[model samples]
Each structure stands twice: as structure tokens, then as C-alpha cells.
Target: MSRIPEIVFVTREEIIDELWNKGIESAFNSNIYAYTWYLDIVSPGWSALITDNYDYLFPLPTKKKYGINYIIQPLYCQQLGLYSSKHITPELVDTFIDNIPSKFKYVNINLNIHNKTDKHKSDTNSRVTYMLDLLNYDDQIFPKYKENTKRNILKAFAKNHTITTSLTPSEFISFYKYNGHIESPAKEIKIIKQLIECLIRQQKLTLLGCINQSNEIGSVALFAENNDTIYYLLGARNKRIKSSSLHFLLDYQIKNRSGLGKTLDFEGSMIPSIAHFFSGFGAKPCKYLNYTKNSIPASDLILRLKKELGL
Candidate 1:
């Protein structure tokens, strides 16, 4: 009989060798969202469950609400769960989930694409994301785009809009604040700025903007890439643009990045129109899991009251 490995909970300062070797060695890279520095920016108080050998890890982004410490998904983090150096089997996922400390009574989070399991199927909901494979050249990849997307790209070009990759982090943040209509807390926006600056320093960030002849910003997007994948982290468009500058901006990236054997992860949209827009670019749906459990009394009722009262 084989013995199951023991898992221990540790605070942010306790991480020793760094998960994924601080995301240096590509051989051990799992997800950029799970990187220690990324977590520090997004969720400063993050902790984790790990084996003694550091083969596997489960990040817990926790917060204290009404004096109750609970796990909640942090802003700007798309997915985080069992990130391991070894094969992430269903059994391994269950083991880490089961070990989540009981102190975190209310749990709601998203697991990465790799953390597949049937054990929590009843409590988990499916979420959709979109990814475009960029293994082929621009000429080959352009044809795969749906007619609607192709038309939009043409429309943008007809308007003489140009794509620029020179937007600074603060500039993007200001654009997002004024034009993006983002509803996240101001503090979260600050965190995003910090994250963007950090990524820039690491040379992992790609900030692109679409500009008109008059040099007005029409659309912009921020992408973070590892060696092989680019995550469309955030984007915004000028509502006044009559043409499809956002589409033009994305198509520019597609053309620039195609033939590089990479993937473009459209971080996601559950809204039908947004999802359709992503699919129009030949992006395929990628499903992840959303797990939620509330053991606290009247939690839902309290949330409902807060929503009703506009709290």
C-alpha cells in the first residue's frame, strides 16, 4: 500500500523554494497567475497548501469578513488551484481540496484548467474562457477568423486607425478608469497598476493601443505572456469609435504573434455578445471550474440584502 503525502498550510512568508521555482525554469512552469510575485500584487495575504517536498501547491486567497476568515477569488486572478510539478491527477486535486483548512468556512474560487476532478462535481460550476492557437503564419491564421471579425478588422483599417504598442501602465490605467467602466474597487485598480508595472519590469507585459489619425486612443489591451502563451489580461475601448478599433488592435496582435507557436488566452466572458466576439476570432472555448460553499448562516441573505440596498 502506498502512503498518501501529507499537506501543510503555510502563510505567505513561509514559502521557501518558491512555487514553480519563482516561475524561472520553464520545465516547471504551470501558470503565471500562480506565480508568487503575481499573487503578492493581487492578494498580499495569500497562503497555500503544500507537500513537504514542494511538488504540489494550492493557493488560498483569503479575507476576513465580519470577523470570519473565508476564501474568495481575488480580483485580476482568472484561475488558481492545484499547481504541481508532477502530473495533476484527479486524486491529487481532491487531496489538496480536502486539506483546505476548516477555518476558511466559506469557500468560493476558480480552479485552473489542469485541476480536473469529479469528487466536487456537485458543488462546482463550469466557467468558459476562449483561446486562440497561433501556431501558423498570419496568412494561414487570418482565414480562420469568422466573417464578422474579418469585416471589423477591415473596417478598422479603412478608417486608417493604427496599432501602437507604447502605452505605459499608468496611461492604460487612466484609460481604463475613464473609458473601461470597470466596477472593481479603487484599491483593486491600484493593485492592477502595481501588477502591470511589475510585469513590465519582468518584460512579460504587452500593452497595445489603437490610435486614429488625430492620435486619439480608440482601443487598448494589456497582455501578459510567458514563453508560449499570451493572456489577454484587460482591455477597454472608446465608446465613441464608430469603427471596430478593438478588433483591429487584436488582429494586429494576431498577425504579429502568429507563427510563433503561442496561444492567446482571451481571459473570458460569460456574456453572450462578448463570447460571440471572442469566437469570431477563431478562439475556442476552454472550460474551468468554479467551486463555492457557504456554511455561514444567512450569508446569502446578507448578500441579497446588501445588493437590494445598494450596499
Candidate 2:
């Protein structure tokens, strides 16, 4: 029987990318790479973030415990080799951990679905993140959500709202401006543009657009589809979208794609308000570890020295 190959470490630009590519190939979200790159732009530290996604390869910061991590990329990683730190156990993980330069206090976070093989559980010390499993999945459709979501969706439908999908820059801008999804979404917005461009170049973006006929306010549901999963990454509609039905437009896409994989990942919920927004969709929580080992003393010392010198 062909066995799963041991994950031999490779170049940050090479092996790291293969790993990321593997996850993206398995239907991981495209926006993950952008956030990963944002960290690189914001801090640009000892980020050992490695990934194949050309537009996104950089370190991001974490507000975790006492240390930092070189987050290469974020993903809806399902497979062990691609999007998970599941293989880097306490015993063998040290090798990779030791290689990491300590200056990068930003821990890497890879949110993944829990399967039987993932023996490692997340903790405070690790750079892992939690997950939200989409419930009532069916291969042909998104699973059943709570009554409130159903009503919202029904309301969107009942209003005879016009819905369309796009990855066009104009459309994205429209969506951004319409819903005031512009502010406080710098990293996310930047990545959305990058992903839109990348997917458009590859002809792989399946951006969904919805418009309320009565108000002319446009709602957008941005999604990327692959063989295994469909990620409902971004949703935006103007305040005119009563009850925020644009969320429903996006949720409908998730429900339609639930049965396609073992679990549907609801990216993250850093803010309680946003968490509440995603939670209402009925996905259970999942988490991952953000493991770190400070190997680069020189980098760490330099960063510390710089901070002290005010340089």
C-alpha cells in the first residue's frame, strides 16, 4: 500500500508552498493567503511564512501568550500535510520549532476541521485557532440553519431581491462602499482584491452578488469553489439591507455546499459581534495549536535591541 510520505521540510518558497497548495487544492479558502501577507506587511518580522500562493506569503502577528510565530499563511486546511500543524507533535515538532527565529512573536494560526487523525489538541502556548463546523450538511446543499437564519434568507428571497456574483474590482468596490465594509477591513479588503485578481487570472473565482431591488442596495457573497469545499469568505451589503440579509445570501451558499466535505469551516470569529454573526449559522467550534520554537536568537536579540534603542 502506498503510504503517506513523511513531511520532509523544504524551502520556505518551495516546500512551504507545496503544503499550502495542497490545502488550496482541497478547496481551502483563498482569502487565507491575503491575511497571512498582511501580517508580513504590518510587522515584516522573522516571519517564516511559506506558501505557494504567489500573492500571499508573509508573517502575521498573534495576540497569544508570551511568544511569537512566523505565520506563513491561513487556510481551511483539512488534509494533514497541507493546512494543519497536526503532524508537528511535541516530540518531532521541536525540530521545526527550533528552526524558527524568536524575534517573530507572532504565532502561526491554521484553523482546521477535526478528524480522527488529528491527535494534537490546541492550547494557549500554540499558534493554532478555533473552528466552526457547519451543521446539517448535505452533499447537494448547505445544511439547515436555525429558524432566524431561515427567516432572513426567506426575507431576502421574498423581497424579490436580485442576486448576482462577481470578482470584479468595481463590484468589490461597490460591495465595500454599499455596506460600509470598507473600514476596519484593511487586511481583509486588500486580500479580497488580491484574491479577486488571482482568481480572475486563473478564471477560478466564483464571487456571488445580490442586490435588493426595492432599495438598489447591492449585497455581495464572495466564494471560491473547488472539488472538496466552498468557502463563504466575505459578505457585504449596505445598511439599507434590512436585517442584514446579505449575510443570508452568503449563508445560503454555505448551506448549499455543506455535504461536500466532512465539515464546513466558518473561517473565524475574533470579535464577539462577528463571532455572533457567524455562530448564528449553526456551525460547531473547532480549534488548532499555534506551536512556536525560538531558533533564531540573532533575530530575536536584534528585534529586542531595536525596540530598546528605539530604532
Candidate 2 lDDT (Cα, whole model)?
0.46
lDDT (10s digit) by residue, model 1, range 52-163? 7677778899787655778999888999888766677777787788898888878999998877877888889999999999867556678889998989989888889998
> What lDDT score belongs to each candidate, Candidate 1 first?
0.83, 0.46
Count of clashes, each model: 0, 24
Residue runs of model 2 more than 4 Å from their true location after superposition: 1-90, 103-143, 177-188, 255-263, 291-311
Number of clashing residue pairs, candidate 1: 0
Q: What is the C-alpha RMSD of each candidate to the true structure, in Å?
A: 3.4, 7.3
- Clashing pairs for predicted structure model 1, backbone only: none
What local lDDT does model 1 show for residue 64? 74
lDDT minimum window of 10 residues, candidate 1? 20-29
TM for every model, in the order presented, reads 0.91, 0.60
